[model samples]
Target: MAVSAGTVMPAAADTDPRGYLKIMKAQEMWKVADGTGITVAVIDSGVKLVPGLRSESVLPGVSFMEPPLEHPDQQYPPHDDFVGHGTTMTAAIVGDGSAGGPQGLAPGAKVMPIRTSIGTPMAFAAIGESAKGVRYAADNGAKIINLSIGGWWSLDKIRSAVEYAQSKGVLVFVAMGNEGDGNESANPIAALPGVFGVGAVDLTGEPLPSSSYGHATDLAAFGSKVQLRCTDNKGWCVADGGTSYATSLASASAALVWSAHPDWTANQVARVLIQTAGAPVDGSKRNDWVGYGVVRPRMVLLDRAGDPGAPDVDPLAAPAPAKTPTPSADQTSAAPRRAESAVAESGLSWQWPALGAVVAVSLGLGITVLVKRRRR
Candidate 1:
């Protein structure tokens, strides 16, 4: 299972001592765009409504997890957070910092929390079902989607869902792994064309040693020692380090930019972000360590240096011509395609026959390890 800020100046008087807002110049950027009218979908454990989240910041969401066998039709509220990971990620995107809560980067944006299985017996299978959640987000008017989880499995369902969302002009942000190495392509979805793969950086703006890097690594953002307030009342918890937090920041930043330029296409927004990212000392050189560079939304919102490139041009060239992703052993159903209105209506289109069995028997231990590693 995989799971998932602050501000300001004048001597860290704000709740966030790290001064991410001051460093990113978020307040200055907010003067121009506070992510108004933008909706970001957070696909993770689940998001539980808490005081930190504004009353209208969250929308009703659907879960892909199958109910316990005893009650096949039992549906869990989308606001429920099983492991506290989803709620934290949701807060990072739209939290208002009310009552000592951690403030979100895009405070004016709204979030749709979609819960999949995390740290559960059905983790991997639930991950396979993420394709449905991705499609749902794109269909439900989400402009930006945040996926803080990743797996080594290369399932076609996930790939197709990503491509579908892109075709709908939705920008997706994915996390590069946190295992210290930079071979981010090891995770299939991160390797997908047009999908943004984000890596982790320390408060000093240097790439974290634990952040993964590779050709799939598209951008980097603050991830190390970042403060997050869990919605389950666990107050502020600092991530030891991982790309998950970085992905959320990048997604929220995208919302801010999109909100500012509502007419720009997803490709144009991505191009601006890449063009304005902060590079390391040898800025001219691009490497696997950090693609383009760490995200600096201020460059686009405040400095106004980001050039929205050709509307139809893709900022990231495909790693290779898009190859058909093979469905892993756990995937039995074909990826959903257009002209499937009936299937979509039924809401049973993406289920796999033996996914439950595979998830129950083999994925628990491995997913447990991956989840723990992400938490660092």
Candidate 2:
């Protein structure tokens, strides 16, 4: 169930009031690269030209869903979405904050909206539609493909499509899931060898219980209490927790890194991200709960950390050393402490809400959480 929408709330004057940008040090990273010359294909329901995305930030793309008869005007095609899910994802990656909308992490980058059906009880044809979207994005000029949708099972068509994109040097990122438990075996796309399986964490840097985890979990990012611009409101809504948002951030992070080093290969960019990520408190290379710790693009953009290994080397292809889980830290009170300590050490202040004050929002209408399996 990756399509969980946040409750509509009063619009904020700016995204800076929220902690997501500050926690990731987005402002600092933007000084180096604003994602220029990068296009991230968002494969979801569709993308609407909201105020934040009004500029030429969104590019024309194909749609797999049949056009509704009522709105058959060729001028107004499938790029318009009634559901705000796709729009929200677009905003998270490249929204320009026009007219008080949420600002994107990589505002200078462009997005290609690939419309496809992602509602629950999804028809078998939906898989074909998604596969087609992936292939189309790869054939086009998309440097990165973002699939925030997930399903319960894996299929060859989607796997072949993902492989096709990877072979073409396109980086694909998928949501681990929002099952609220550790059983991520049900959703396989995130487990794909080359695709980045992103997980979520709260402002405190602790892993969200709802974020699915397993061998496929490659990296984690701030996904809880994230601000987004949805069709439900002219303003903004804060998604309580969903790997979909985390996946968007991960894609945006890649855009920032790629924009700064446009000549780097896809494998090189992937290598830098994994290498610069904050390691687990136990000092293991990675773990099931938070992968290689939270993504810290600033480490690469500002501090010049991480060596982009061999261009031809697929980092995930080699088996990583077995993770030594810190039972006391990862599973209990120690996790939050470790996160806070790390933040303090980095000289970053993260303002997280008190645990007692956390409130879950209601999902918007037509926002269905779908799960998909990986090709492995």
Candidate 3:
């Protein structure tokens, strides 16, 4: 989801001023755990060794792209990113803020870049390649897999790969697509079981109009106006709206939690994230738009909130039960009141405001492309 040439804008001179980090209170949380000893596998175009990314922070990776006939010597290196989308995603997770670049939330975590043909004409043909990349990451000591790519159609190969990763005790976070309102299509991989589907939300905790909504959406995160280093600019670029950035941040959040509790299984970490999330505005248990609520890792880090439920039981294994209207007073008043308090306590304002007009930039492969896996 590279930004179109017309929408590209010069970044401000400020160094590593990511507003979402402040909104999520990530800096404060870093004092407790900065995702050390964790490795997040970024599955995207490729991760260029930008100044923002330290060499040690990025591990040697594999690329699934075949060499183009015109460039016999050009074996697409996993560290060479042409589209900049993958670089942006990587920076969001593990950037070190060198050369006045964006600093990532999980700065202590390592990134394993798994390159695939995304944001190109070969995107549709790379579905199988991406699936293989997933398995590769899962088997190669990656604790979490960050997928900033998505499509409208599902493939059995991809589903099977995701299941394999889950069986290997890997956490997969995926972008929930950016088709705005009226578009009912769900990103096939994001909708799969055991995957954490992430949506985009602004500072005010309002869902971005372009964020795709459905039962698959598990959580929302700061995505609008997110600042990151990318190939689009020599410095930084602000992404107006995209679920891709949200997914990266969510992956980083998981890394931070897992680092703090190294002994916790993937299910335990997932349960704590769900239980500690800011409650939905409407006070329902969960909603299609924002899922349980915006991710508030600060709640878990600072306040020591959230219960790590059964170690073997996955909180997201089954679809959330439908919101049943009950006549009980405590169910009606107490829950909604507590939900409202929780939203405020988590530092997300419920007041919705009209989004200002800005040059919107697509920041990952999921936003601008839809690949259909051809059926046999």
Candidate 4:
């Protein structure tokens, strides 16, 4: 889940990111737009059904967060938001009202909300349960599942859940992370095998330092100073400036493309975004920051530029083939240089962690001794 930067940044920072509304561009891109019947699964913190954004586009959602501790409130239902990120994202993807706020990319698409965002470092039970939520969406009929959360450490349940979703032909997208620490800390859900990791860019199309970066990142999108309706419908809007927001933008883009071509598979939709994405990188190469590029949703739908081949294959289905990823010359045999200081060279007051795995030997248990004994 993302934290709002409203207080940290200047007031104008609350304005729309990516420069302009770009609604006309979005409309042109969604030339074949029609999402009247499709259902998208947004698995995040509970989404408050804001009245201005068209309550009709949303189906009843389940809340595992609201508590009498054990039993949930069946009458009023629990879709209220506190952090304001999830609500903002839901509206960005599904809002259909003419209230003149942030209209969704695929307004006709129906959103099915699932609350999985619990307290920070989500309980092991919640992490385990979150995976179950994805399976529930898959068993039902959600064509796409958007995961916009990640943490410093990995959760085994989520990795398995992503694999499960893919097998069922559900497209999964995740926020790489907001750490901005680059290689220092690997965010789990985004780094997991099956997820299409997303990063963030500013209004000038510059990469945000706060956005997580890695080869795991498959794409990026605008994430600075974005304006959208408040998740709680508090009669005010908040600015979007996190990779969490970027993930929602990317997810909605996929829905538009999917809606236009109902016959295509998740792999095909992924290929389109990967091919036409606009990251101003050198030689069409990917970077640690922006991955393939910033997603151009309209490009995939309008230019008819992406190729949708082999519906049977999930685009991100296979684990990266072994020995296929490019490697450095000494990758198999070199000992990495030790860090200059165990302090990790950061000014953020973090001490050298107690659990450090510093390798001291090239091989374990003296393998050659066994070979010599066998020869004797």
Per-model TM against the reference: 0.78, 0.81, 0.82, 0.74
Better of 1 and 2 by lDDT: 2
Q: Write the per-residue lDDT of candidate 3 for residues 201-259, one digit (tens) a residue.
A: 76666666677666676777767665554343346655453677778888888999999
Whole-model lDDT, candidate 4?
0.56
- Top candidate by TM-score: 3
Alpha-carbon lDDT, every model:
0.64, 0.67, 0.68, 0.56
Comparison by TM-score, 1 against 4, better one: 1
- Give stretches of model 2 more than 4 Å off: 1-6, 13-17, 66-76, 120-124, 182-186, 229-235, 323-376
- Name the weakest run of 10 consecutive residues (lDDT summed) in model 3: 347-356
TM-score of 2: 0.81
Ranking by TM-score: 3, 2, 1, 4
True lDDT of residue 55, candidate 4? 74
Error of 2 at 222 (Å): 0.9
Backbone clashes in model 3, listed as residue pairs: 1-364, 1-365
Q: Give candidate 3's root-mean-square deviation (CA, Å).
A: 7.7
Model 1 pairs in collision: 182-213
Question: What tens digits encode model 1's per-residue C-alpha lDDT throughout 287-327?
Answer: 45456677778778887888897887677753332222333
Per-residue CA lDDT of model 2 for 163-217, tens digit only, reads 9998899999887666644333314666566888877777667767666666667
Backbone clashes (count) for model 4: 1
Comparing 1 with 4 on lDDT, the higher-scoring candidate is 1
